[model samples]
Target: MKAKIFNSEIPFYELLNNDLSGGEIFTVKSEGLKMTEIEMGDYPEYSEFVDTDAFRDILRAEREKLRYGDSKTVRISSFNINKSKGVLEVGFHPSSYSVYKAFNAIKHYPPQIFYRDAGHGLYEEGTSDWLDTGITGNLIRANHCGTGLFIDCAGPGGVRVIVGMRPNREIIDTHRLFRTYSASGSIDLDDLTPFEGVLREAREEINFEADASQIELVSFGYDSQLGYFQFSFYHRSELSFEEIVTGAKGAKDANEYTSLDPVAFSAENIDRTVRDIAEAPWEPSALWTLVVLVARLILSDGAKKGEKSGVTAARIDDFRNKLEKEIKNRNYESNFKIFN
Candidate 1:
């Protein structure tokens, strides 16, 4: 798969390979991108935060309340290959940490001890972490799978992207950053396979029912920064933007999203959207997912037709050139290797 970023068309797998090769040390420096750096000493309450003996006791009690035999585990795996040679370069599993642990680690303690407790095998045996530590191992360790949906709608104006607003504040705040229309939590121990999990999330989070026929698998890969296998899907909506908004409004109470926002995907407006996405407090995966989606859209058939129109093509090329320069100046390094 190829993605058009900023105007440059790049192979999708190459981006993933570069990202994974960078390991946990890679960072994106751009305006509007919000990255949280945890410094334990900066917070005066740091000492009291880690002392969760009381919380641990509560978690222990909570475990007793769960159904018996709830501590099941799942093995997660992903492999990268050279498309040209059809040679498998690497095959690996996600990091060893549980989903709950990774979430709490990023969100911090005290305010989100619920996740930490869940991570300690109180809720499940092995949940996958959202962030990858970039450590490689041969063992098939327990991990989770996450799904992201990219909903697209075409109208008189142009294609519009629909994303969900996460309602929960105590955990990962969804208000600031926009997420896929629906996304699944850690899939470890779940009966549903990773693809099933994606469809399930669409129904639960957006009240949008989708089946295997309606959803198309756009990309499936590992994000080394966020240590989980991510499956991205594309669903074309027959409903108009107004109808979508109406449906979402009616189902707001039943879903995790408080509301839905449809952003127009056009060369004229992409810069603003990119800035908005960067400024918002978004999930790391959501950010990268949008980047990939935008790239794909730019290379779509519709975009190709627009290129003949002159105006749209010029706008897109300008954007791509700008992005290419930015990436070039950054000197981003990767360590990906191919094995013969």
Candidate 2:
């Protein structure tokens, strides 16, 4: 499909050409949103837990303790940008086995370097126009930080299942989360397709299948180094806890030096079990989802005490049908572009 895009500074129109047959040009509505505006203030405080020296020392300790006894090497890739009044920075740290091992404890995506052209070394949070600069894996370089997500299944009325991977070691501890081992490989870590990657990981790790219908794109976020990313989360059909755990245990490959580990997700113990992989180390999507899930649990619990006051089942079904038709109409319009 072909359309025109114009910037305020440029008086003339610019042609926007695309082969996609059916999609709306919603860019106009999203133009004003900046990448660095996300608030990073609410992250867990680990001030007493780690200092730069202590962190580096831990890395050294883990390397010394490797089963195969290999020395760890660090790799780094980075970039800088000029914002309105400040410089925005984004990028990645070293690409080494030790960095991979550190992912479990950090719980954040890999860290990329962020720096401004002319300012103090540390960029204050929330002062820049963009909240996060992280992008999809497609855009990541070896030393660039790309966006990714951590999605664990929660089913059977809010019971949570943790997803984890272990590479080259029996287990590693970060953020105190007890993660199970899983097969590890150097796959593209783009944010846009991390959902698909997760599904692929699920299949390889535990022989579990994720139907497209069962998956949902519930969260969206970015990192300072990566570009736009979608944190897609999914929940499979009902399965016994033993089945889930068994699936995890069986998800090891013959050639790889990793294994899959799945544990039940419980908020009370999650902080103790789930580690951060990123440098900034926060899962806003997962965190917000937990809040929503918890709220839903409360409402559902209260509903059991009394008659459900929302729409009747029949009415809800009718509304769903109506909504489907509307969506189809919109899709038809969007699909029109591919033909043109």
**Cα lDDT computed for each candidate against the true fold:** 0.43, 0.32
Q: Candidate 1, residues 140-243: lDDT per residue as tens digits?
A: 22233456776766544555655545544434322223344444444434433445656666566556666755665445554333334555666778776666
TM-score of each prediction:
0.53, 0.36
Q: Which stretches of candidate 1 lie over 4 Å from their true place?
A: 1-73, 78-142, 154-159, 171-182, 188-192, 221-226, 249-255, 301-340
- For candidate 1, the lDDT comes to 0.43
Candidate 1 minimal-lDDT segment of 10 residues: 20-29
lDDT of 2 at 290: 29
Candidate 2 structure quality by residue, lDDT tens digits, 175-260? 22222222222224332233454456556655666653455433232312221122324354466544655665546443232533
**C-alpha lDDT of residue 290 in model 1:** 56
* Model 2 quality (TM-score): 0.36
